[model samples]
Target chain A: MEPSDLAGMALIAVAGPEDALAFVSSGASSSAALEQEMNAVLNDSGVPRWPGLAAALLRWRPRLTDLAPERDLRVVERLGGQLLVPEDPEWPVALSELELNEPIALWVRGRALVIPEQKRCIALVGSRDSTSYGANVAMEMAATLVQRGFTIVSGGAYGIDAQAHRGAIGAATGRQFLPTLAIMAGGVDRFYPTGNEDLLRAVAENGAIVAEVPPGANPTRYRFLQRNRLIAALCEVTVVVEARWRSGALSTAHHADGLSRTVAAVPGSVYSANSAGCHRLLREGSAVCVTDAADVAELAGAPGTQLTPEQLGAPAVHDGLGVEDLMLLDALPLRSVTSVDKLTIVAGIGATAVLAGLGRLELLGLAERANSGWKRRC
Target chain B: MEPSDLAGMALIAVAGPEDALAFVSSGASSSAALEQEMNAVLNDSGVPRWPGLAAALLRWRPRLTDLAPERDLRVVERLGGQLLVPEDPEWPVALSELELNEPIALWVRGRALVIPEQKRCIALVGSRDSTSYGANVAMEMAATLVQRGFTIVSGGAYGIDAQAHRGAIGAATGRQFLPTLAIMAGGVDRFYPTGNEDLLRAVAENGAIVAEVPPGANPTRYRFLQRNRLIAALCEVTVVVEARWRSGALSTAHHADGLSRTVAAVPGSVYSANSAGCHRLLREGSAVCVTDAADVAELAGAPGTQLTPEQLGAPAVHDGLGVEDLMLLDALPLRSVTSVDKLTIVAGIGATAVLAGLGRLELLGLAERANSGWKRRC
Candidate 1:
């Protein structure tokens, strides 16, 4: 190898496989020329096979060094992290399908996981300035998502992002490994924001904290936006709670949409400016409106579709009423609300019988007072 | 006509025009039937149409000591002030379309009016126990609706109901006549809640207030449900802001739905127990989702297709920055925070150039900074 090639290889050794891909892609030099000029004469002679390889190689220049491949594995042994190249059987081809923002290489730590096994994974994203309403929704969605055996994925930021991770941890608090994954903008080793240092540590210890940047690399605004595509590519669904019209959480939603992942959002009061982003998503059909954990679970229908018999939580049906009460309730719905006298009029009974039936059903909670009349209750 | 004919006429009048048509088609008792036969036939008829003549004749019976058609008008005038019978073209046909709940005769005060005019009108109904969120929406919708020359229709009751009337009044607070209407359950003289007496009086003086019952009659629960159907029929649209799972507001929405009027509801926090009815309406597709007056107006579309240039208001489009900004704005969205540097990278422009353009756009009030990321503003 030339001295420069050797130096690039050493940098790859230190920067890891993924960093090498980014460096090469950034250089945009070499004109994607092969290590040798052998293909030049073949291409001049119009050899279709050589041109195809040449075009693909040059075309791959952008995504290639994102993972920064090393021609030799011996150098990879020096770094604690291992290289995941395109040729690796376990390397997710799904991510490569992300097109421009696709990772050229993945610098993974701990267990090298497979994407398909995490099919139920969901990305939770939202405003950095989340309100109590947004936070509650994020936490609820996260908790229920994890409870269903779905892995939760999110950026380890403050506001809705932090709550989402916390909710996932709360869901799997006592489990062996956290079913929650937190992606960071900076290097995996350096936790950014210091505020979430403890939370990120828990995430790293229990679940994986994946990043495309090299170790010790400080995350720039550029890198974080780049990292978001991975979150979108990895998850089956992405949910947003609260965001301003300019929140980055929306970018995650956009990434999810581009990746054909289900995007869900919690709706907020129209009066709240914080919920404007979520409303916009719903209006433009960018995200399905979600209410609770079950709602999110229903939309994604992730791997954790199963519900234990104990957790089946059924709603109470008002079937225990007497025949007379049932008749009254039935008559009441004949019109959505009925005055006692009208119930008598519609039921073809006396006022006495109608009043008695209503009194009984009200006791059973099968009906409620509506304005001056009565309406059947769920 | 035979004395027996008087009895049949009374029943037929009570049955109303639609029921009268049905009565005639079904070969039921004629208006000339004897009092006993009329009573038996009216009781047996399953149809809910009112026989107006019957109420008029019944009222005159005490003075006549015999059935007399001439005394009917006096009886009507005495029972509830002046009766605006259906025969009077000044009477709104909107009430007759409620089918079963249709009143035999309406007693109205203030300036007379006809519906399906050049004006757009909407009914706002919800719980008497409305949350602050619901009340605020009611106010905005009514004020905006009234200002747009759309008459506001609502029950003269408490909570959301009261707010609707108040908002309409506030919109044109000191105008010659506020563009607001109130439909009451009882006699016009007997304001049901009594607390809204002044508002109801203002509605009558400014726009309209109508009652289906006799002048001296008090409102029964039966009357309120019956009143809801009329409210639904009179307006072009009905909106339910906040309601319980089983609420009078839901009934009003259903009545509007049945009438084929545009029905909409403002959504609220799912965490709120009060918003359950609105959520239920959205889930069941009983109402279209609406957050503000413009949405309701746009969907309902100014009552008629031909709007003058002045009435059409602002076109939906904003200033310059056409398709590309819209596409990019749509592409990035607003949940996850996306850095400006990343946006330039994605859009394939130098960071400095993109920042300049974004700043210019921001000065134009089309972009907002959220967590240091830029996004298009609505």
Candidate 2:
């Protein structure tokens, strides 16, 4: 193509290297065509694009370069309807994987995403088969990290990992805005565990949900270990929440040390089997001793002054989620359904939002207009 | 003095080369008495001594020939205790305190006073506030070392140290007779931490209790750390049982490492505050890691082979300590007074043997005979 022909490309720009690669591979010269082709690729890849994606892409064009559009578009499509790339202004650079097995793209729908470039963004990792003792300790440390204004990063797995993310996200403090970054091994569509879907969704909506693998990709054991290295690399420190003697947590610690990052370990009872890996790390000199997130933040060279709850960050603040609203949402039929007063008694949302919310839901495509009043559609 | 008189005089030994100057100043002949007077002078000087003392007269001995001795018995007395003659079979020439703060003379005791020439002895040490886990581990390693026939050595404190002594003393194989030694900070007579008094007595009876300080000296905190170098010097391997962040155990470990002795440590729970010192040692590369006694024994180069109970050279195997005998021993009055009826009820021994045993006990100086009956002297 001539240099003059390359000038025909309109507004929105992409800066991500992966998006650049995807655009070049699609053989599209214009941003609009590139986006449509990217969406096609997502459909081909078995992921769905969001409804307002084209409009959102156009708004992001003035804010980002040509490559940013492709990457952000792919991210939203891959995450399904749960997450949307709300803006380019509040995104985490720490979640950006640099080349080697990078995150194909990031899918986030949080209130804020503020991962500072110069500051350390550590991810505390450990086994899903964590002991109760480990889980409690992970929670305490995550809370402490958030209180100290250190963004708590982790894999959003069950056990210790889940406790860590929950701690940072639930902390009343507002300093933990985009501080919590969850690097999942699987795709970003919905919660993988189903039990933790609400938790994962909370994290994505509050902080950020990140993945190196694209959406619809299932997390494999190998990917789990590979993702650990990312956890170590993105932050100045990596903490092992709890690990068995032969656990992937040890691998993450080793990766942190290899990257010249500080590796901290929480000690456990001498008899606790969950602490064996940490003991091994402590014995091997691969990890520093840490009792709380403050220790980690200190190791990361962050001063340990604690932030107030309001100062910590506003990640989990939902605009309108109440008990009645949830009860109504849960009452909806799993499959498409019909009937209004019958649904009202079961939903308990009353006549007010039920009428208004149904229209809003219909507009959102979550509910479709049907025979009687309306039918719920997933 | 005549030339023949000079020939008749034994070689005068000064505490050090500088010590002779005092002898000359005292107007004593440069004979053995001169050395005695000089030692008395030096002992009264209030100068402190350090461990690993080989000798103190560094090339200055020849400059003080004008010294003199006055009496012959004083000459023998001076040479007997103050000087260790190489011709004396009790001398262990292989024990060298090179480059370490050298001693004027080592106060020696025990069977043979034999130090292995060109062989190595390793020191194992750790916390007095040890967990049961650390003690058991220390014992196993001691037993293993005994099997390998390396001399097991340690401080005679409670916890790991006491266990080490017991393990070494209980060596069944007799592969290395008189296999254990305890180095004390205080005088060998005043064992600190009274709980270990019985164990110390057993150690004294089974092996040896050594101290660099003079007899009847109380142990100060400084002296405990001061004597650590001797532990390091006497052994080729040092095992740490368990220690808090700040304990005497780390001092011994550091000394052993400085002296180039092999240092090993038992790994403990990461969460335990007591094992923090051990963890720190492991972190600093001051000690190798060991899980069990076998691991430590292997590090100590101790031998272990299956030896039947019969093959074990137990001093004089007695059946499980009989309750009746213990009662008899316990029944002895505070003073030397006892009645036959009391003896019968106490011992439950037959009339013949009770008398015979009493007679034997009397002979052994453990009992005394009075016109009324018999009583325990001890």
In candidate 2, what are the lDDT values of residues A333-357, reduced to their tens digit? 7566756555554443335546666
Q: lDDT, candidate 1, residue A136?
A: 87
**Alpha-carbon DockQ of candidate 2:** 0.03
- Among the numbered candidates, top lDDT falls to 1
* TM-score of candidate 1 to 2 decimals: 0.65
TM-score of each: 0.65, 0.57
Docking level of model 2:
incorrect
Lowest-scoring 10 consecutive residues by lDDT in candidate 1 chain A?
A1-10
Task: Please tell me which predicted candidate would have the highest TM-score against the true structure.
Answer: 1
> Which residue segments of model 2 deviate by more than 4 Å?
A1-99, A114-118, A170-172, A267-273, A289-295, A303-378, B1-100, B108-112, B115-120, B144-150, B170-173, B177-179, B189-193, B260-271, B280-290, B293-378
For residues A114-233, write the lDDT of model 1, one tens digit per residue: 333446788888888889988888888888878777778888999988999888887876655447887776666666779988987776655667666555555655556667888888
